[model samples]
Structures are given as C-alpha cells and as structure tokens.
Target: MKRAAALTAAVATATVPLLALASPAMAQQPAKTAAVQTQVLDWLSLDALSGTALAQRVKELLGKGYVPSALNVTNATNPQYTSLWVKDTVGKVNVLQGLSATDLPKQIDQQVKSGFQPKLITGTGTGPSAVFAAVFEKTTQLAKSQLSMSKETFAKVNAEFTAAGYSIASLDVYGTVEKPLYAAVWVAGAATGAVQVTLGQTVEERGKELLAKTKQGLQPVLMAVEPGKLYTTVWSKGSATGLKEYLNLSKLTYTLKSAEMKALGYSPKILSAEDGVIASVWSKK
Candidate 1:
C-alpha cells in the first residue's frame, strides 16, 4: 500500500537547517524573489526527462546557470504519494527520500542541513513503470532493508518443523504464518494429494503423538487427497476427530462430481447441507 504525504513539520525540519546557515547578510535578505522563482522554473524544466534521462538533464541544467535548491516529485496515482526530494547547493546535492505520510518538519530539517532551497514539487503516477521511473529519475542512490512480519511468536514452531521430518520449501517472513497461509513441504509417499494440514499449536506441540492418534482413528476412512492440487484447510475450533470426519465427508461429495461420474452420461442432483457447509453426495442415474 502507498504511504500518506509527509507531515508539514517534517518538511520544515529538513529545510530549516540549511536556510539558517546562510551568511548574516544573506539571512537578512527577503524571501525568494520573482526572478529567483523564474530561475527555479527554468531549472525545473528538467522534470520532463524521466529516469536516467532526467538525471542527465539535471546535470545539463546545472552546467548552465540553474542553482536548484530542492526538487520534490511524487506519484500522482498512488493514494499515498512516494516523494523524492533533492537539495542542491554549488556542486553538492543531497537527496531525501520520503513518503507523503512522513513528518514534514523532520524532512525540512534534513533538507536544510543538506543545502539547497526547496524548488520544484510535482506528482505523477499513471503507469506501473512510471512510479519507479519518477522516483529514480534524478540520481543514483538506493537503500534496501527487510521488514519482519507482526504476529504471534512462531519462531519455536519454525524450529520444530525443521526438527520434524518435513523439509522447508520456502518461508515468507513478511506475513502471518497461520492458517490460510501457504507453505510447501516435501513429504514421502502420500505427497500426491494437495492436502493442506492445519495444525493447532497444541497439536503441533504434541506432533507425532497427535499424528499417531489421528492415524489410528481415521485409518478406515482417510484417503489420499489429489497430489499437486491447491487446497485450503483451516484449523477449526473442535475435536480433531470431528475435523477429520468433516474432511472425509467433503472428499466423498467431491468424488461424486469427478470425471468418472460424468462419463456415465447421467446428471446427478447435488444439494448443500448445513448452509453449504457440507456438500451432499449423489450417484449418477
């Protein structure tokens, strides 16, 4: 999701420092005049060029007579704007990257210390590539970091999976790891069915003990779910035996709708039971 615009306080903080550093005489001068504004417009015309082209264009503008204080650009289409601010003085420039939702005062302080008065600010976000292009258009500095997911502690559970006979295929650390989440594993023989297992924390803790009990209880009815099929399962708040019973009934109903039943050239009546919770099984006529 896009972030909101930076707060005004952040903007002020970023710019105030540099503005304060001007010579006493310069400090006494009035705010930017119309002539300086005109110069800024001439310099900012470089916004037309995007990506590397824009960066090169900025260099060209700088080579001419344009002294860019700051250039701010944001994605117009994103509900939350991703902004890029660059402050330039003499030949030195510092770029401050922030989301529109950032505190403006902090941003201003940082910008001021970096030099350059705030100049051009624009927004554009029409196409997918445009967002990235606009953000990276004027310079080549990038930072990368990883974010962790916020959820109940699952570190111990992850370790347990390793300790068990399951091979971890992939772990997505950016989201919750509970039911409805997809995680692949390499199991032996019964791997054909796209069977999603929902194990409660209690069951997971018991591990093999629970597995053994389930195997004994469902030995007669448990069938292999089709392999490689994507299925979703949830850990319902109920007895383990009851959950297995529901799955068994669901599988039986699914069997009635299989290709084999259709090959008989007969249409069967299907109905929903328990408010569509349980699918009713039917035989071909």
Candidate 2:
C-alpha cells in the first residue's frame, strides 16, 4: 500500500532550569472505567514542577477526573524547572498550577487583547535525564462488551510498528464523550540506528489503512469509529530535548492550533470529534 508522507522535524536543545511550584494537592478518588483515547489540541501551559512529583500527581488527577485526557513530558537533567504534563477535566479550568501567577497570565491576556493569532508558542525543553511521557488520561468506560474490531485494529497497528523498528512501551484505554478510544504509546529505538520508515502518518490515511487490514473486506462503517487520530512526541536522550506533533485531526489541525486553545487550555478533543476516531494529543513540556 502506498503510504502518506509523514512530517518530520528535530527539536531544539536547551538547558533545563528546575523550579518548583506548590499548589493544593488534589484529593484522590476511585478509579474510573477505562475507555478509548482521543487526540486534541488548543492547549498550552507553562507547568513548573518536578518530573517525579508530576508523575505521582498524574495518577491521582486521573482518579479524581481532572480531565488530563493525554499529555507528554520532556527529558531534563539537574533540572531547575521541570516541565510537567498535568491532567485536566472537561469545561473551562486552569490545569496549570502557578503558570497564571507569572507574566504568563498577562501573556495570555495580552494575546487576547492584542489579537495575536497564535502560530506556535513554546514548551519546556530538556536535559540528559529527561523523561518523555506519552500519557493518556483514563476516563470512565462506556461500552461494556469490548468491540471485536478494537482488538483487531490494535493488532494491525502493532504489526506495522514492529516492522518499523518501534515497539509498544505501553497501551491503555480512556473514556471520552459518549464512548472512548485506545492509546498505544511507543518507545523508540536508540540513536544508534533506526529504520528510516515514517514515524508519524496522517490520521486520515491511518484510518483507511486500518480499515483495509487483513484484506478481510472490512467495511469502514462497521468500524467507522468516531474521534480517532494519530499523535507522537520525539525526544533525544543525547540532547535532553524533544519535539511534539499532534496533527492529523479528524477536523482541521489548524483550528485546534490556536491562542484560544492556549488560554482555554486542552480538555481532550473527544467532544469535538464525537464518535469518530482520534489520537490523543501530545506535548513536549
């Protein structure tokens, strides 16, 4: 099968400055039902946190339903300011801890005041000890009996990645809108040598390929899944830096990439995609 052109770019390098912020620790709750994952954009934050601290916080936030559908982390060293990917819930909320306290709030305010159409602002850089997390927020499950097609689709995607010299580091499910989607996060091969195969593909093309798998004459509508897309974040241990790409939206990627998204922040694009298939959005901070 002919492949879609995958976009590729290298992340820049920077020395990670470590800074810590103290916020009221969120209370934990019972685990929610597992559901599918969806990709979303329209959020950007300057989270000042410790990576280990943030990791522990993620587990709790997901439990309490803070709405961090999915997030990513950056590699850093004796990090002064560690970039944390926190969970967020549906609706308007300030997911970042002390970001607004800084000039960041004014930055957000000025953007709206000046009408600066946002292109790409910035996210946290990294250090050698940097850890990149391709995290998916788990929400309460909807569909009881698992769909047969879900397993099959995962199988096909797995096979392709294996052939491409990438392996699944983790797989998870999360709830969204009415139902949910799956998230298959990967850890790449060492910088020693990697297959030149495409790492990222357009979501639309991926959907078609998924439908065409096994030559089983599978109808698209049977799995005409809602809210499905592809996303990935590539970071270099050698450089302790990374680049995140969250594109191939069922809708236009450009729309999600907005300052309004930065201010309103992200809340999983599931509501936007509905029952459609979407790849949960990722970040490099």
Candidate 3:
C-alpha cells in the first residue's frame, strides 16, 4: 500500500560553533559557480518495505546502477526495511542482510580487506541475537571509518577525529534501547564545521530540536531510533536554502508530503523509520 508524507520549512535563528579543521585534501576544491547544481533524478525511496520484497528490489536496483546509501529495519523482530537508493558510478557493491552480531564484524573485516568499504550498516535487536544489515561499495570515497562502538566510545572517537580533520559522512545506530552502538564513515577531505548531536530524545523533542537546529543552519545527517521510542540525531553544517525536513510523521502523511515535495522539485536525501514512524529530509533540486 502507498503512504502519505509531510513537509515543513524552517528559518535560521542561531548558530552552533564547530572546530575549524580541514585537511589539505579538503582545501583543493575548485570554486563554485552561481548556477544551481544539476538535480539528480535517478533515485528511489522506500518506506517500510517488507523484507521479502526488499530482497527482490535490491537485486533489481543493483543491476540498474543504483545503490543503497542509507538503510533501516523497523520492527526488528519482523523486519521491515526502509532505504534510500541513488544512482552511482558503476562499480562492485554488496549487501548483507540479517547477519548475526558475531558474524557481522568478521564479514565486515573480510569485505574491507577485499577493497570494499561498508557504506551503510543498520543493526536490529539487542545483545547476542542482534542482527546487522550492511551495504558495501568498492568505489567508496572514505578515508577512515569505524563501526560497532558504544555511545560513550563514539563520543570520544568523534571528538578525537573531529580534531584530526575528519568529518562524519554517515552514522548508524543499533543494539539495546538504552545503549545503542554507533557506526560512522569518516572522510578526511572535509571540515567538521558546526556539529550538533541530540541523544535519547523523544520523537517530539527531536522534532523540535531539528527545527531549531535547521533554523540555525545545521542539517541532520543521521537520525537513529531506539526500541524505547528515543531518537538520536546528528547535525552538521548546511545551507538553509533548498532544505526542508519532516520528522515523526505517519506513513500516510509521509507519502502525501513526499509527493507534494516532488512536485515542487525536491527529492528526499535522507529516509529512515522507527516503530512505524518516519523521518525524512528533502532538498530542492
């Protein structure tokens, strides 16, 4: 069944201070022109797709030069998949679904050794029975990456890395409701400008913060939800122009809003689900 979507806009109010560190690689970018960047049209967004259906869809997308950039599994026990697929340069890509906790690490190591990077990792369940779903790509632009860290450890590492001139491109959370593990992909050629993270916030609280942060020029890069209905959101620097986001919306509202945004020349760049509620970020083309 199709679902509805929602949309909201925000204005800048405040700013968050971030360390000014950029690698030499980051400083070599060419100047930008006034012309708007070309809008990407070859993409698909899935909202609460069933596991069985997702398997077939994944195969189809891979053959069409599309890859999953972000993924989440709602209702971990039953497993409903949500993901964002975007067209990418043709290269080797792999997807692993529902791998046991013990096996996930080993498999990730194997893939990394084989010249592939885990582009996205989503875990479900907790403790010994937790399972992970990952997408690996051979043509990744990552400089350094880490996965399977506790909340406390991630904070420490995030601080250290930010100071060392690395910016997080993506983050994934999984495990128990009280203590979720985090995985992040780091790139060296970027600045960790103006970062904000909200942990263990309720859907409403996170939504409010998201609005405020985006109003202050911070864009959400990742939003993770726990079984206990808590939300963790990570934000980094982004232009308020051409950006809009919606959070904690029902499937019907989400679908409706998505269509409205599409008609206005916007595309969903981020999509994730938790306990049947959806959160998404749409950017103007």
Candidate 4:
C-alpha cells in the first residue's frame, strides 16, 4: 500500500499551548467497525521558534519513536504557528505544536536517513497552523485466505458460466497448490446479483462441479448483463495488492513508466503483443 500523504500549515509562529484546547469532536465519537482510528491535536505553540529550531523539535519527536507516516504542515491562520495531527499505533494520536527551530529536538536528521520521508509539505499564508502525520508500524500481513487463488481450471469453469448466460465480470487466478488447484471468479448473472465462485482441490473435478452448480443454482436467475462495460484482466506473480496486481495481466504497459514499473517491481517491456494490454502495461503475470 502507498504511504499516506502529509498535511502542512503555513504560519511562522504563534502563542498556543498544545494542551490548552478541548478534545476534538472526532475523539468523542464512538468507534465504528474495525478500522484504524485517527485524531488531530495541537502539539506545540510555535509563536517564538525559529525555522531551524522547529526542524530540530520535529527531529526530537521522531527520535522518540514518533516517526510520522503522514506529515501535514500548514500556516493558514497565524503566520508563525502550525497545528499538527500525528497518528501513531492503533488508537493513539498526538496533536502538538512547536515554537521555533530551537523548540525542535535533534532527532529529525535520523528520520530523513530512514525511509520516513514526507509525501507533501507546503506553506500557505492563512488559517490555524497545522501538521498531520501518519506513524508507521510493521506491515500487517493479509490473511492467507485473502490472497489464495488457483489458475489452471478457472478458464474452463468461467466459460461454463458464460455459456449459462452469466457474464463473468472479473476473473482472478492464482497458482497456489496443485492437483485440485484453487481459483476465484466474480460473475454477474441475470438473477443471482453478484456472486463469487471459489474452487478448491481437484481442478477438473471442481470445474465440473462448478459448472453443474452454476447451471442448477445460477442459470435460473441469470439476467442479461449490460454491454459495452468492458471487463479488464490483471495478472501478477506477486501477492495481490488490490487492483494493481491486475495491471500486469491486462497488459497496460503503455500506462506504466519506468518509475512506476520499477516501484511495482515489474518491467514494462516484458509483455507480448498477443497478450492483453490495456493502456500500456503488461496485465498478465
């Protein structure tokens, strides 16, 4: 996943205590679902600090294990002061302020040496000074079930669905396991709403079973799918990273530049003309 962008404030300095403000309304709102909670706060009053000192203080905060994953600094209200939003681990956020370069700690230099570079940092001439940061933690591994797939027999099974009047919207295949294989496809039938077909074990057997099941369970409700809404294919040897993995399978090579291709750990030129190419990047693994 890409790193979150940072927010920046433009004020030079202002007299505001970090702990003097009321808790933000978001802090009071009840948690919903299982998503990460984020909050904004006032970290320091930078009314009297110099630019160098401000930088130092930022270094100090980072050194204490507060490396921001996203950092936003702005100066809209006070010309000198800036507000900051710092998101740390789950349920932890710090809003602080800095007075000057002197007020900044010395740990910032170390952060730059590390990979925690800010995505955006700009200065404006109005509003409350603010900075937003997204702290980094260990990358969470998606569950195995979330990434497993089979490739060998998916084409045949999907073909059966198409023959039964179901439009296959998306076909995803992965080369996991052997013998039975594993595969998944998203299909839209006239009557079955949107359904996902997952095949596990014995590719040929599962494919036959899936064909029979679709005829028995899905064909009765298959609706006429809309035309012109082209379905794009994507393939990747790497683990699925959302829609990006499919880019290679669809052969969208022209859309991928050197930098983007490198970032995805893929080579843009390693594609075939007969293979599916959308926009200019290789869409197949």
Model 3, 1-285: lDDT tens digits are 122111111111222221111100111233222222334435556666676677777776665566777788766677777787666645567777766667777777877787777667777777666656777777555546666788888888888887787777667676767667876766665564778777778866876887798788888877776556677778888875787766666666665666556656676777766676667777788
RMSD of candidate 3 to the truth, in angstroms, is: 12.9
For candidate 1, report its TM-score: 0.20
| Whole-model lDDT per candidate | 0.26, 0.28, 0.65, 0.26
Cα RMSDs, all models: 27.2, 20.9, 12.9, 22.4
What's the CA error at residue 79 for candidate 1, in Å? Answer: 14
The numbered model that scores best in lDDT is 3
Model 1 scores what on Cα lDDT?
A: 0.26
**Candidate 3 lDDT (Cα, 0 to 1):** 0.65
Best by TM-score: 3
lDDT of 1 by residue, 197-223 (tens): 333222123334346545544211111
Ranking by lDDT: 3, 2, 4, 1
Worst 10 residues of 1 by lDDT: 17-26
Rank ordering of all candidates by TM-score, starting from the highest: 3, 2, 1, 4
C-alpha TM-scores of all predictions:
0.20, 0.24, 0.77, 0.20
| Candidate 2 residue lDDT tens string, 1-285 | 111111111212222222121111011222122222333322222233354455455444334333333232221232122222233334221222112113333433433343321111112221222122222212221111111124346556656765665544433332222233333433344223221212223455544443343143221111111222332222121221221223333222323332223323332221111212222322233
